[model samples]
Target chain A: MRALPLIPLLLGGWLALPAHAADPADARIATLFNRLAQAEREQDFQGTFVYERNGIFSTHRIWHRVQDGKVIERLLQLDGLPQEVLRVDGKTQCVSGTLVAGVGNTPDSSGRLLDPLKLMSWYDIKTVGETRVAGREVDIVSLKPRDQHRYAFELHLDKDTGLPLKSLLINDKGQLLERFQFTGLNTQAVPTEQELKPSDNCKAVAQVPPQAAEALASWRSDWVPPGFELVKSYVRKDPQTKATVSSLMYDDGLARFSVFLESLDGESVTDTRAQLGPTVAVSRHLTTPKGDMMVTVVGEIPIGTAERIALSMRAQDVQTKQ
Target chain B: MSREALQESLSAVMDNEADELELRRVLSAVDDSETRATWSRYQVARAAMHKELLLPQLDIAAAVSAALADEAAPVKASRGPWRSLGRLAVAASVTVAVLAGVRLYNQDEISGVQLAAQQSAQQGVAVPQVQGPAVLAGYSESSEQATGPMANGVLQGQAGWDNQRLPGYLRQHAQEAALKGTESALPYARAASLENR
Candidate 1:
């Protein structure tokens, strides 16, 4: 009887050899990514970390202590501008300096969204090794893209809480483009009130009253790497360009990017493209019924991928345009 | 091309003040032996950084110039006294070369001055070829400034801040990403870094 059961087990393992083992890892990452997304909505905890880019390293002090389950985290720019951001819960509560404005708010906290689970299908997640961060031993999770369209990520998860310790944005070449890591962290102790105080430069920014979530403007890519999905899309008029820039943010579970389509209003927009670190930007000149238009795709994706995305932008009813 | 302009671009790049244009210009013409020598010397002095080790003997630009000189010698000898005019010819050629290089420097290899500053643009540069002669939308004609002073490393007054709109867009992009970003603090830190600056 035992032998008979073992035969099926062996056959099943053989039949499902690849994904059988990988399914669990994929499931783990999906869960972790979900948790990480949810963690932003989290209302509590205080931690300190360091951020480095192009080797210009800096340390940061962050106090995110919560009360009555309302999150109040104050992040003081440990160096330089003395900038600060105090957010209550997940919403930006107050800011110092300028609120890099012109993000045409859709007015809905629930509607301004990106779905993470939809992205997981296109990315391969695997546990790489064990490491220490902020005095805590953590598991290294690598979220590698299945396609060349987007960059891969290596994330260090806090072993105790499954929080992110370090996140690295890596290109298809496996080169690290940007790194965000917590050099030190603490969660056991609630941060003191004084730690959350903003310096003089930390001016208060009024909460952008949430507006009604705009209707989900339907858009589909003319071409996208298989398994990628529309994670978010909206239109924001650039104050400078004065053109209605329709944006669509896409994701393959792990990899994400945004596409902005703008009506040129017949303005001459020289098709331009750029790459900064891991983030690749592609702009394409597109013609529509209205007139000449330019489509730009931005985020941590490959140049070719971004170009393809820029080309793929289309009006839903172009055929119906009469 | 005039040694000074080239040197200025090179030094600016070394200081990280050079934008995409300077960087591309330097990289494209880095083949000159004397240029390569100067580049290597800068590398040695730590004032400039060449992405790789430069072998003085392996300098291709200098080698080509040397090869051309060698070929020119026989031609000059064949012409003899006619080429004695060659000494005068060379002096004229050097002066012409300087003028041509300066002209190359000042005159756009491709003109119209409308070329987009080498930017982190998603799409590549637009073709200078305007088949329709159509003035593109958003082209503020009459402005000698193609992309504002920022493209040329000059700030146009508070107008400099007037267009630093990018800094805002960059921040908004970061903050929006952070608010809706997935598991990584990369977006959050990016927003934070922008705030730092």
Candidate 2:
């Protein structure tokens, strides 16, 4: 009798092992990421959240509403400063005075949605467990980085809405580099138009297309960490310095970094590396045939990785016409 | 000095109007946790008004004090540059160095020490080829503080060539992040933080 029972148990165990060995776990994780990416854009809700890194902590109130197929979002800082930003249809309509000033004129580049297939290649996404955040139940999902170049993220996403209520950026040693978590959430009702209106202090921004410079296309990064891809590149002249700064931005779907190359114009500047909260800025001098250019890399990455990215930056020599 | 007087001195310091006596007074009490908290609050209020970027919790005085404490043994006996400055001047210099370090670049060349500022970012760097450009001049890294100004979590405008250019770079990086940011309000917060005085 015991043998008969053992036979079924063995069969059950054997059946489950292969099924688990396949892509079901990966498929589930991908589905969760897809839902999470879609939720923030499609959903209409309001909440209060806090962002913290190192010794700095700031609280904010966010009201995201979608009406008539247009998404309007308003964010206001709760402490320290009354900073505010209002975006309509994924483009910034106005911003609190002095925050972005003249920089807001550039055409907005719509963000890349979280691609599960690409993300799977760099991160091992798994359903860790369940937890409660902001008075709502959430499923804990871990995006463990497969390499050392990036940090791991443990996201507590709301079960019903699939919105990330709590997210933590953790280093390999388990040190928390930065955290973004909601303290309160309300998904029941959409925010009103009046609530989304820019404050009196908010100034409308003008969008100016960057002047076309052919030199930007000639510059390229000789090396970048695996899984990272160049997302956007452009050249813009500095209003203050009057030097054309060529910028290249790269992203690994989740992590992003920007590289800026500006000619010194005979002004000597030493190489520098500084870390601000979770963001690291590294400036290195690279001598190109055009001139001595200052290459700076800024992003939310480890200092070593950033420095490597800085050193790996190389200018492509222009081919002479026959 | 009385507690109220010390508070007034702290305020005066934040406003950049404090005399020598008031500066010394605030430095003495800066060790106390309450005093530090009050200092942070004042910084926050001032930063908010100026629309300046600030890391409210960064205790520059405390980091200086820790740096001083670590150097206690050798300071009393040696006639080194630090010893020549005297105790009072050393304390004052600590304040000035930490504050000014954020906004100024070294005119004189300082060898870039790759490992010096690697305080917390020393993990997972497998490639030895990418050690550092060199120890940069004016790049102060006390035992308690990381890469001085940058690690302070705030951007203060320093009237220098590099200082002027740095803000543009920081803003461009931040604004680009915000524009391309589909993740959440994190990028937006980062962009906003850059605007403070």
RMSD of each: 16.6, 16.5
Give a tens-digit lDDT track for model 1, residues A53-136.
Answer: 433455667776657767667776677766676665555555666554444223343212233344444555678899898788
TM-scores of the models, in the order given: 0.59, 0.66
Model 2 lDDT tens row, B50-78? 89956776767778878988884654445
Off by over 4 Å in 2: A1-22, A99-108, A210-215, A318-322, B1-161
TM score of chain A per candidate: 0.77, 0.86
Per-model DockQ against the true two-chain complex? 0.07, 0.13
Best by lDDT: 2
- Largest TM-score belongs to which candidate? 2
